[model samples]
Target: MSLGSHSVMQGDNTLRAWRTGIDTYQEFVVYMRRDCPACRSEGFTTQARVLLSAAGQRSIVATLSVVEAEWLSSGDAGLSESAWAALGAQPGEPITVSHAPPLYSLSHVRAKVYGHKLGDTEFAEVISDVAAGRYSDLHLATFVTACAGDRLDLAETVSLTKAMIAAGDRIDWGRQPVVDKHCVGGLPGNRTTLLVVPIVAACGLTIPKTSSRAITSPAGTADTMEVLAPVDLDIASMRRAVERTGACIVWGGSVRLSPADDVLIRVERPLDLDSEGQLVASVLSKKAAAGSTHVLIDLPVGRTAKVRSEAAATSLGRRLQEVGAAIGLHVSLRLTDGEQPVGRGIGPALEARDVLAVLQGAANAPDDLRQRALCLAGDILEMGGVVPAGSGLTLANQVLADGRAWARFQDICAAQGGMREIPVAPHRQAVDAHASGRIVSVDNRVLARAAKLAGAPTAPAAGIDVHARLGEYVEKGQALFTLHSQAPGELAYAMSYVASRPPIFQISPTGESQ
Candidate 1:
């Protein structure tokens, strides 16, 4: 494996393409027997980087996995789902395996690992390779780690953001003031985007809002919105929905906007590393590529939230504004309370119910959720000049109160495809308090962990519903929260974690836990 060559010595073995039911999160993987002719001829072993070519028209770099099972024979090679889709190979098609070409852009990553700043051209080349799926997960991890913890300066951050935007498809609305909003998420049950999009759109703004699925939380905006209508709209469908209803709520991954961000996100989620520079780049790149002229960023601050303090929030906000301005976007930052989950529900369908309650103006809707959505929507309204500086809240409230936002939401859902009823979990259990006292604190991170353990986002209907609020009085054996799951094993797993940990809800007679 030379580092300076692009030529690959093709192997003599031609194997059948067996589809392995494996999910590698967009990374290509190929499985072959330990004693396969290709492995012996090409000097390939487990974990080797190999180039897979089919029909001389498609080629991809994949990691090698050795299989000892009967599912794959010596003359057969198995492709993971991602690889199979990338190659578009039939089950019995012949494929060639060879040594992968040298990834020259990785040298820049090595320089970054050694504390050297990368130039704009270096970042462009690196991001191009990343977006093209030329890097393995290990390479992605190394690159992400190298850029972690304030390693990238302001200039470098701008370069990276620009590089990321250039690496993906950009949508041009050919219109002014294309508005969008994003929340720096950490707290669970914060599904405000679902409400804010409808409100802003109802005010006659072009708001094609694209959201991501959950990475670490119980639910993401896309995951929750998917419960009511489809969120995986392609660019054309998304445009059509926006044209029909003045707005849309769809998944960002479907549009190829800032594709490098998604590629990096796949690696960042498992590592749990979100550096400041990368965060700014990730947010602004998508906004820029989405044709947004004005953007609102929500920063929720708490001890357990992503932005933990006022100082950190200010710094992040400044960076976001600076990068966004450099990329031709007007960025407005808002710092809000992240003391607890935004609503009573902490999963996909459960959060969708909360959103619907707010939109429909139900008396039982969570006041916190409704008020937060109103505030964000108000700010967005002002940003788009749809309302006066201080009067956006009044207008937003009027729209929601007068049933206009609800009507707009339904129209947008229909335009996106169709609306569906929210689902409910099949199995449920309530966790009760052991001692009676006024509740003082709730750990957002722990509660979110329990919800994920209960199979949220993935299970669609699985999550937790809160019954106790901060400073609320409770009796011994009173219900504090209910866990929803699709399977008994998942419910048991969440319950076991809750049983072993400190009470997620802290209560004291004096209310001093805060």
Candidate 2:
């Protein structure tokens, strides 16, 4: 058996499609036994890019993984969960495997590697192939690395953003001034989008916010939002939520907005490389694709944060504005203090609790989270013309104080499959202060990593909950932060990491517990 255009290569190249049920996130994988007839005749091995064609005209290029298990017969070819979904394969279906086609876009990537700037058409060719899943993980990594460390100039950045937007669906709200907010994330527990959305929506503006999951941090807006409400809504469901409540906070990937950005994120996540141009494109492309006319970006600058310094923030902020302008978005920047995490929680469910506290006006609510949310919401309000420039903060405060934001948030959550109860990790351990002193500084990267090691985002309830703040004095045995994990193993893993590192929190001999 053979496909017409994508015919099988010489030898018996057909195999029965078997579902292995392995989930590799978004990376597609095809499995074959080392001694399989097709593997031997076709010279297939691990990491080999193979073209797979299934029934109903479904096909995908997947990285090959050789298996030696007896359960997988030589005649059977296993497909990972991602590959299975991509091919829409059925059990015992016929599958034809062949060499993946040559990638012509890599030449542009090669040119980029040699310090040559790419044009719009070149970037488009590369991104389109990326969005179509034709590029392997190695190729994706090469392209990403070549673009890292300020390699892409202003023109290239704009072209890349345009290419990204063109690679996916774009929402046409058919209206002016659709608003949204995004944070150039690095600081953990900065889940302000949750508080800002309801506030802005309460002030009579449309905020169809589409957020992303974590790329290089413990949790992102979408991750924290998912802990409160269902975030993986389809395009129609997302529209209904926005129409019914004038706001929606859903994961952008589900709706296929900026599909290329989602693809690029698969590599960027592991590399921890949210590069300059790629980052601007990633943020602005989604905002532009979401049909947001006005956007407020929260750029946090600190020594340990993503931006690191005021100069870097300023440069990034300028590029953001320029790219937003090019993409028809009025981008506004707000550089906030990124000295430490925003809220007490640094994971999905943990951060959700803080969001709920702030929204419900709980007495123990984190003031920093509330105020930061208010400030960003106020900027969005002013930008969208809901209130004047100087009065936006007051109006935002009034909406939150009067419970309008809370009520609106409840409605939004109810529309998106109702609110969920935040989960609690089964295992908890506290990292105590080594000696009585004032907490001078907290390392954002280290804390975020610790939370990730505790199984955050993937395990929504697992993370770190901060109990101490900068300038606060603590006793020798006092808790600086508590590690929460769903399993004792995960808790131990995070504890081991913390144990082998420098103190996450710097302590001074004298001060006043804040």
Query: What TM-scores do the predictions have?
Result: 0.96, 0.94
lDDT of candidate 2 over 1-514, digit per residue (tens): 2112223333478888878888887899988879877888789889999999987778999999898766677777888899999999888788898999988999999999999999999999999999999998899999999999889899999999999999999999888889998988888999898899999988789999998888667888889888888999999999999899999999888998889888888888788765889999999999998999999999999878888999999999999999889888899999999999998999999999999999999999999999999999989999999878899999999999999999999999999999988999999999999888888888999999999999998999999999998888899999999999999999999999999999999887866323
Most lDDT-accurate candidate: 1
Q: List the residue pairs that clash in candidate 1.
A: none
Compose the digit string of candidate 1's lDDT tens values, residues 153-193.
99999999999999999999989889999999998998999
Report lDDT per candidate. 0.91, 0.90
Stretches off by above 4 angstroms in model 1 are 1-13, 68-70
Which consecutive 10 residues in model 1 have the weakest lDDT in total? 1-10
- What pairs collide in candidate 2? none
Model 1 root-mean-square deviation = 4.2
